[model samples]
Target: MGKKIILLLTVGVLAAYYVYTPLPDNIEEPWKLTWMIAVSKTVAYLNLFSEFLGANRFVNIAALSKRQEVPPTSDENVTVTDTTFNNIPVRVYVPKRKSVALRRGLFFIHGGGWSSGSFALYPHDFLSRKTAERLDAVVVSASYRKAPKHLFPTQFEDVYNSLKWFLRQDILENYGVDPKRVGVSGSSSGGNLAAAVTQQLTEDPSVKIKLKTQALIYPILQILDMNTPSYRENSHFPTLRKSEVAKGWYDYFTTDRSLENAILLGQLVPAESSHLFKFVNWSSLLPEKFKKGHIYKKPIHGSSDVAKRFPGILDVRAAPLLADDARLRGLPRTYVVTCQYDVLRDDGIMYVTRLQDAGVEVTHNHVDDGYHGAFFLLDLKISHRIINHYIDWLKENL
Candidate 1:
């Protein structure tokens, strides 16, 4: 019995090593290798232990189950009104709570890589309520129609019109929110919208709604180049891979039916203009410190058919980082959060540098060990550490 037990233990140890070890071992970058190993260990542990204890599997199933649950307090004391902006549908979130005085107001846009996301997907809807309770603020979370259906300028127009509606309604007087303290915020694609809205507001002479602050969390500020160091390093990272990033742009410009398999073969952007756009100069504006772990290379040009199919991608609104220095200078007080492991980290860093160079007041937060979409996953207990950091920053800044 003792001999049999020893043999079994040896076999188990060997199995564990094999499961955790990643093949190929050809990942050139040290950090990439380390990150891959860590992810491999995580997956190995989940696969090996999940069947026996089922803890990881159970948690995943529970999360899916939770996504189906109607948000308990979303409708209570909160009024959701449907309206049309530039022929696009939008839903606004307004708190019904009584206030002692005027409050701060937030114009929020949802994130889905500019392709998919709704106001309901925000975990902070409850937190937005708490913000209303604490800061005496009126949070307007807008549900703008997404891409492929609405196209590029349509979403931007919808958001702009939503802001116009807020101003038209005299939200400050009715909701007891201070017009001077109005702000805009969002994560990922929504962050891009927030930045764009802030820029457009600054440019518009007719619109008197001035944004006091802007919050951008891991935003995709540019769309020109995909060959940044972060992209090469985190190309295979799950959830938001390089291919998926390209696919997002494809889906945004063309409808779902237009997404043929050939497009995925790098047939989206034209070859001549592929290198003509200023993606790296604008998007790769990362601080020298952020690039210590990787090397920079000139981006390889894309095929001619690729560019011809997606010409609208070169627009400044689609790639806000490409906006000139004059526009960057006109932006409001900005707050940017970046994650070390995210492909979009450099984009945020570059925007901060541009804003600072333009003399815009900027508050920057770098999450060293955090990954993309970490803060949005706060409802999950596994991501609590990163979530706490985000909440702490919001408390101090917002």
Candidate 2:
């Protein structure tokens, strides 16, 4: 065991040195050096180190895993209420401050690649109370059923049902909120759910309640094509990657792993889907402006097996960018935030174009120095500067 420990330590040091040396002279803006730091930390936590370092890595992982459950800070004014929304769990945040009548309501969804996140995983009660206090709004963060266990439509249904409950119970009136002033906001995968909920609301007339606006921070708006310029550039980026994003969607929607094989075989969609569906224009609808740093290329055709495995890829809810002109036109005012170095950046840009073209009011903020998962890192002392800027944007817009 002693000899093995020595050998493992030697190999780990060698590998770490190889990965760290010869760094790029100009890594560019939006691509921060901290990303490389995060990669190294991930490696350390994965137990790829030698026996000597194994204990340290295990300790680090344990600390991080534990921190995920720790409360953000001690505050007695913020109260968290855990209750069921359509049989799904949800957390509501109410500030202990005096406010004007009829406060604005914010429906928040937490992000975790659509599978692993929970209501308790986020400091939602804290952040939501802060936002509510500053903006004079009520924030309700829903805990939708995760994927692989609950599937795609299930998560969607859970959120939709929560919204219905919010409306049916006259929550706005009960909480002194103006029904017309309600809004929805989320980050990453939750951002995707927020967009989906908004889209679903556009077609549901039975619900007269209107969503005043939508706040999407680095949202994943499309799924059919993973070959976007950002995807190519950040395919292997830490925290989030094209392959991981694809795998996440597959795992969320199917009970069997064979769906992945079917998607690769082009069997997800029917042979006539090309003509039946408008994926060409939908996928290629990106604006020319965002293409400034992008190199244009013709899209390759998918295999038959690829279509069979993931047939639901064509659904607009799975790929909001594919929604028709009418639906886009009907959507409420939108605020989209994108990060330049993020893989899903182009999706936000293109969706903005589609919304504006469809005659919807749209406001956009592009975070040039940001990465995919940067928004959630705001609470960390080191990342507070950037995360505060995002919060400021939300405050101003909301």
Candidate 3:
């Protein structure tokens, strides 16, 4: 047993050596950042091997391998309520301070590659609490059933239903939220859902409640292109990597691990999806700056069999970037943050550009030194700087 543990550590050290996780001079406190990145990747690697040590499967309950499902209460600055909406668990955080009138409202979704975010939504994170107190807004965070344990549309359905419930007139009024001034936001995978839910509301004639604003922090907007410049450059950046993310998407779509290799080869989308290129094709939508001269080639349509087994991958609810102009046009005022060294960076870049082309108002901040999920490193100065900027945007838009 002792030898096995040493062998695993040695293997991890060697794996770390082969991967390209370098500290770019562009970033601040490079050594500290590298340490955090190393720890994050190592923990995730360990989680995958935990079965040997009698630990529960990491991807089963929460994306982070965390088992905490019990909701937590914040200190005096915020009032916390644990409840359900549309039969889905949610935590509402409202500032305890006195306000001039009804405050703004924000519907937030957490990210974990569609799996890890399951456990942290219930008033357990810092950003949501700060948003409620600092922006003087009522915030609701939904605990969507994650993938692998659940499945694709299930996570989307939970968020969509919960947002629809939050939009209810009485619900907003009860929380002292101004229905006229509400918005939605998320980071990474949650950001994808925020964009999808906003687009969904815009298209649904029955949903009269149009959101006022949206903010996406390093969001993964589509599954079509993993060869974007960021993916090629930052393939080994810590926390989120291209190969790992591709697998997460495949897992979210199906239980079969066998077909995921096809996803990596970029053929899992099948040939029929070529029609979606005009909307989500990064070659057309991404700015020349992001391209870095890598010409976009549509993934060859070679996996009709895999695509047929599960067609949900291309559903607009799963990949909001695939929505057409009519759906994109009515979207709310937007704020997008993209990191230079993150595999999914281009997802936000193309999305905000498309939103602008459709006449939706937009505010964008491209963090040159940033990597994916930077704000998740709560203790780091760079992370807090990004979070503060996001909160300030909420102050203006919400």
Best by lDDT: 3
2 against 3, candidate with superior TM-score: 3
* Model 3: colliding residue pairs: 63-116
**What is candidate 3's lDDT per residue for 187-272, written digit by digit as tens?**
88899889888888877877767799999989888877677778888887766778878878977888888767776776656667
Q: Tens-digit lDDT track for model 2 on 1-398?
A: 99999999999998766555222333332234454555645565465454365464334543554566534332566556777766777777766667766677888887777776556665555557667666767778787766676777777788889977776536667766778778888878888888988998888988888788888888887665566777777676665767668777787778677666543333344556555334324345666655656655434456665556555577776677768788888888888888777888888887888888899888887876566766656434424554455467656655
Worst 10 residues of 1 by lDDT: 21-30
Best candidate according to TM-score: 3
lDDT of 1 by residue, 6-62 (tens): 999999998666545332233223344445556645754665577576564434433
TM-score of 1: 0.73
Where is model 3 more than 4 Å wrong at Cα? Answer: 1-21, 52-56, 59-71, 118-124
Alpha carbon lDDT at 172, candidate 2: 65
lDDT of each: 0.66, 0.69, 0.81
Deviation (Å) of 255 in candidate 2: 3.8
